[model samples]
Target: MEVLIRPDADDAARTVAGIVHQALAEGVRTLGLATGSAPVGVYRELARRHRHEGLGFAGVDAFLLDEYVGLPPAHPQSLAEVIRRELAEHVDLDPARLHLPSGTAPDLFAEARRFERCLTEAGPLGLQILGIGVNGHIGFNEPGSSLASRTRLKTLTDDTRRDNARFFGSIDDVPRHVITQGLATIGEASHLVLIATGPHKARAVAAAVEGPLTATCPASVLQLHPHATVVVDELAASRLEQQAYYRCIARHKPARHRY
Candidate 1:
């Protein structure tokens, strides 16, 4: 695991965008994408590069990490719509190349299995982008989720529901379930880059990066990944005991090494 600490969110975004750009330059085609405020800056930076620097996503295929189970595809708060509004529509990537699990399928469990099969057939993702939740959840694989679990429908915890309520206008409007890739599925990616910001995420970040590898903190699975990178602002890195060590390592890492 590699951790990079930046002064603020924008700097962290720039660092991550640089890594993504380098990955594309090296001919990486399959990407795992994430949504939410934490990654908005990274998307904005990438979009800027697309608009001004001619960086293109036309050749890339993207898979979303998860989706709210009961939300309509057209719903404003739906993960699909959020991705479109935030990243996909802003890039040159083909709309058909963006893959999303069907959260609204009549047979949701079957849909999840189908999605998992398709993902496996496609092989390992070149790069998987992630956003750590304040509660240490990743892609809705909440506390108590099995480390070897696969893609499936998962119940949302009250804490998670409350955290997401603002996006849905009210707590009551939040979906009770979601379809998410499990830790095992995420671990199959060739690379995992998690971006986090704000002091609110400090404790969870510490728990994920420095604490024991346990399902109680789903993000802790990153520690088990062969190639995992955690990019966070100083505020979010606050609780990390090895902050100085991480900073020094990042500073001394070879330029040839991305992230």
Candidate 2:
């Protein structure tokens, strides 16, 4: 993984925004996307660019990494709606091109298979955006998840649900299961951009960037990707073994070294 330590979260977000714009210039349409706090800044940066920098997302296709099971698409806390409110609505994206995991499908297994088929038809994704869970889970691929797994329905760990509960009105309202793209599926993308920020993510970010390639910390699977960029802010890089190199990089870009 190529680690890029920015001055702060916003600088990291701008770096990601530049990558997104480059992808668009290359005629990219399908985006393997993720939902969570780490990526919030990225979405905000892209929205700002779309509005003030004369950028657009008219033909971009969005595919979420996962969605809570049993939640209606209209649910305010659903990934579908979150993406819509946070990013889609703010841009000129086509509604029909927005692909979300069907949380309430009658036959979930079939739906999972169909999701893969749709991806196949859409052609290879130009880039996949990811956010590392505290437990190192990527998408919903929890610890011990096989690297070869595909899109499927899986139970959400209590820790995961609790972490997500902040988005809902209460902990009781969060779903306990979800369908997500597997490690193998996400790793298949042409480019992988994993954004992590804040001190809370230090341990996980360290594992993803410098630890062994293991399923225990699923984000470590990023090590196997051909082209992966691990972007994190200074606080999140606190636990990294390469902190000195990161400090050196930041020193050169004083404007980006906010913290």
Candidate 3:
């Protein structure tokens, strides 16, 4: 995994946005998107580029990473609605081309199979964006999730619910279950870019970028990917042991691999 530390969240977001923009220009039309504070800035920057730099996503086929089970699609806190409000609405992406798991399906197991099939049919994602949980979970794949798991229904842990509580009225309002793309499924993307910010993410970032490959830190699976990039603000990179080495690598990155 390549770790790029920026001075701050905005700088980090800009770097990620540039990677996405460049990919689009090079004929990448499929994207796997994540929701949460970490990626909000990246989405905002992309929106800005769409408005000012003529960046277009007209033919893009986007897939959401996960969604809360039992929540209505129109729910303000739903991942689908969150993505729409944050990025889709501002760009030229077609609603019909944006896919998300059916969170309210009567048969969630069947829904999981259907969504997995949809993802497979779309072919490999050009890029998959991710946000690490305070506990190092990716998507709704909580601690102890099988590294080889696939798209499926997962029960949310208390820590995750509490962390997401700020988005709803209270922890009680947060859904206890979610349908997420598993680690194995996420690993299929051609490129994986994970964004993390703030001091709260420092330890998790370190564990993911430098720690052992273990299910305890689900994000650590990035280490096994052929093309994975972890972009973080200085605060988030604080706990990483090889910060200097990562910086050196970034500084000497070859021109063809600049992004």
Q: Please provide TM-scores, in order, for all candidate models, with all chains considered together.
A: 0.98, 0.93, 0.98
Whole-model lDDT, candidate 3? Answer: 0.95
Query: Which lDDT value does model 1 have at 228?
Result: 95
Q: Which structure among the candidates has the greatest lDDT?
A: 3
Q: Report the lDDT tens digits of candidate 2 across residue range 1-259.
A: 6788887888888888777887887788778778788677788888888899877888788898888889899998888888888888888889998998799999999999999888778777899999998899999998889888889988878888788888886779988888898888898889999998899889999988889999899999999989888888888888999878866764675563232
Write model 3 residue lDDT over 1-259, tens digit each, in one string. 8999999999999999989999999999999999999899999999999999999999999999999999888899999999999999999999999999989999999999999999999999999999999999998899899999999999999999999999997999999999999999999999999999999999999999889999999999999999999999999999999989999999999996676
Every candidate's CA RMSD: 1.0, 3.0, 0.8
> Which pairs in model 1 have colliding backbones?
none
> In candidate 1, what are the lDDT values of residues 96-195, reduced to their tens digit?
9999998789999999998898789879999998999888999999999999999999999999999889887899999999999988999999999999
- Model 1, residue 258: displacement in angstroms? 6.3
- Model 1 deviation from the true structure expressed as Cα RMSD, one decimal place: 1.0
CA lDDT of each prediction against the hidden true structure: 0.91, 0.85, 0.95
Q: Candidate 2 versus the native: TM-score?
A: 0.93
Name the regions of candidate 2 deviating beyond 4 angstroms.
246-259
Worst 10 residues of 1 by lDDT: 250-259
